[model samples]
Target: MHRLLVVLCISVALVAGAEQDVLELTDDNFNSVLKQHETTLVMFYAPWCGHCKRLKPEYAKAAELVKGDDPPIALAKVDCTEAGKETCGKFSVSGYPTLKIFRGDSVSQDYSGPREANGIVKYMRAQVGPASRNIKSIDEINKFLDTKDTTIFGFFEDPDVALAKLFVKFADKNREKYRFGHSNDPDVLAKYGETEKIVLFRAPHLANKFEETNVQFEGSSESELSTFVKENFHGLVGHRTQDTIRDFKNPLIVAYYSVDYVKNPKGTNYWRNRVLKVAKEFTNKATFAISAKDDFQHELNEYGYDFVGDKPVILARDEKNLKYALKEEFSVENLRDFVEKLLDGELEPYVKSEPIPENNNAPVKVAVAKNFDEVVINNNKDTLVEFYAPWCGHCKKLAPVFDEVAEKLENEEVDLVKMDATANDVPPEFNVRGFPTLFWLPKNQKDKPVAYNEGREVDDFIKYIAKHATNELNGFDRSGKSKKTEL
Candidate 1:
């Protein structure tokens, strides 16, 4: 029956992709087929995944655009559940849909670019380009630097210089993340310098008088070039948007305000200038960026910053995943103070915890972020934690069944705890990605929690506890029952 279902899923996927310009790959031909193309963007996905279904048409459109790509960049898919189960397992694809770039036998990299058709086409095209674009005229130089992308331009007295060759190799390797151009023409070299040198033109959108418009790469090696680019890429005060947030390294101190470069460039720089002053004070301690308030207003609302006036809200998140926030007027002095306190661990973390319950002695106990350590982690009992979001429909449906299970196990030395995940800061130990996530933490083995992936019915929970619980229940059976022991 399971084999039949797998074949059916593959058939369905193939029929859906028949009209689209996508390759249906299987374990049988996975290795051989990928080697046919120099670059193939293979998506290891399950046919039943909702996200993969939505991304199908967009990926198909991208495949059509790249059909004519030189060195042959093919967009393909592998149904992980059936045809490509072994192939997906080899690549360690744990998710429903995972996109990876395969370049022959080379180490595959995650396809981190945009998912839409046009964006995917542009991104892949960059992968097949010359190491660096040729800059013949000064006009070409200006035009290349005008883009929102960070561009690297190298100028050498002779194009065949050792430095120029090194630059080409570096550009070839990092073309996916940055744009590169070069000119050996004396006219172009005269504009910048007569000797071989590289200038990293930080994106135009991030232009400010606070820092140099173009930074010099003083190093010779590729590793040094990479370090210099990553360090100065965002400028002194980085303008972070939704697209660029993940790029910023942690130990980040970001100020959220009106950061509009198109409309109010001067006013945008005004707030940024203040942040830059403090940013300069702590150079290597933390990375500073300014995000648009309107862009991330919804995120701020979740942090209890709604209706808080337009004063720039300062928030910091360290490498430890702990979050901190300060909604106050910024000054060169106070902003520095906040960052110093954060570094010193003097500030209390800003957690989205609901107020601790005065009475949590019920069968099903409520665990808030504020009281989670006391009620769940530090307690001397085996616990079943349900991290749920209030808006989740699945959590709503599971409520009655979960409560009934709690009632049945009330006499046992176990905690059946539920928390509103939305209004709480879960510890990093519990990676709660979705709604209605359940975990079983044994009293003796609190460090390692087992996820409850069994059926939602009471019996399933009882069976799981019986097998894993630290102690036997009194008079009640291990398999969630009252009266006499069952096994």
Candidate 2:
């Protein structure tokens, strides 16, 4: 089954250019591409997928049919066998030649089985309705404004059977409101058909806006299905997007720079306290939270912001409209005032957030260092050195806890230092594979900073650190007594 998917995917990619509606998805541009269009037809495939290979030609024929002057749909192909693990995982694409249709940024339809062109074409017309215009490229889809009527989106791969199920459910319910379709076609990728799925919509008279309510085709047991919906349904709830974000109409974007540990004596507390006061004042009308110190970039990307070097910039727009966003520099007061200004119809002189405090201007006692030696060294206490990038989300989620742990152990027996791995240098010798890697080194043996713990849990990591610190201070071999069973 996997091999079949791989074969189909590679073949489809080869012919993707022939179909204007169809597209190829990669990690670098998948989100941006989807954001630009309304819907899409995707085929998750791999080079090794034999079933996919067989489906390629059929998919191509479907693409050609859908590219007619009045063709009804578009098609796309996703090569999951490459370095697209993250992209595939995000969409919960588990199998090859998994057919799915994305409406806005979420999956609106999906398909599997019977890899034939006619079968695929029949499915597309049934789901999205007859295409109003012929389109051959994603660029053309971008140029084409969507109609006001029903639209169909499709994707296919063998492992995406569950995704197909969700699409089928939505299609059944909204048959008149919209047409959702898919197929695991062999021989070609339905590029033009896929592209049509995105730009076409039900005409306003025919469009049932009332039926556009939240119809969650989801459950706890169907995580993969939900993920597919989240990534493809740009307007779905729990998955933030320009349209979905409108759900938080009177929302507040909180921007905080303090690490949990450095929040207090570091005088970052002044701002922290002030933010709480501001948060309370606008509690009913706004929603906000502190950003992860490490996840600055991810935050920016998630919210579709440009830069995050400045302290957290609170960005608020109509929860229903992300396009009309308001961003302000540090301080909850400034942010509140900006929101007031927006509400008041004064849209000029918006304040930009302050850039990160650098060098002598830094608020924290630990200054940003360029190299290992520049990292502060302590002898009496164990040292916890964290190597992190400024863009990681998981790292951001763990920031507060990391800070708290350091603050609790401060001055007594441990030194906590943070290093910018991307900006400075992280040697391969350290075996660091991912971001926010925590290295624990005994104060006595400063040169060898071994990998301590990874992942997001704060309490578990703190306990592990304390245990190692105790051993180091008691004149015991810090690396002694292997925990692993000896052969």
Highest lDDT scorer: 1
Q: State the local distance difference test value for candidate 2.
A: 0.52
TM-score of structure candidate 2: 0.27
Task: Give the poorly placed runs of model 1, Cα more than 4 Å off.
Answer: 1-112, 115-131, 157-165, 204-210, 219-221, 307-310, 475-487
lDDT of 1 by residue, 388-424 (tens): 9999999999898889878888888888999998888
**Model 2 Cα displacement at 264 (Å)?**
61
Off by over 4 Å in 2: 1-92, 95-371, 376-381, 454-458, 470-487
Q: Write the per-residue lDDT of candidate 2 for residues 66-114, one digit (tens) a residue.
A: 7753333557777887856677888788878688777655788666423
lDDT of 1 at 389: 90
Error of 2 at 240 (Å): 39
TM-score of each: 0.72, 0.27
Please give the distance, in angstroms, between residue 256's alpha carbon in candidate 2 and its true position after superposition: 40
- lDDT for 226 (candidate 2): 38
lDDT measured at residue 309 in model 1 versus the true structure, 0 to 100: 53
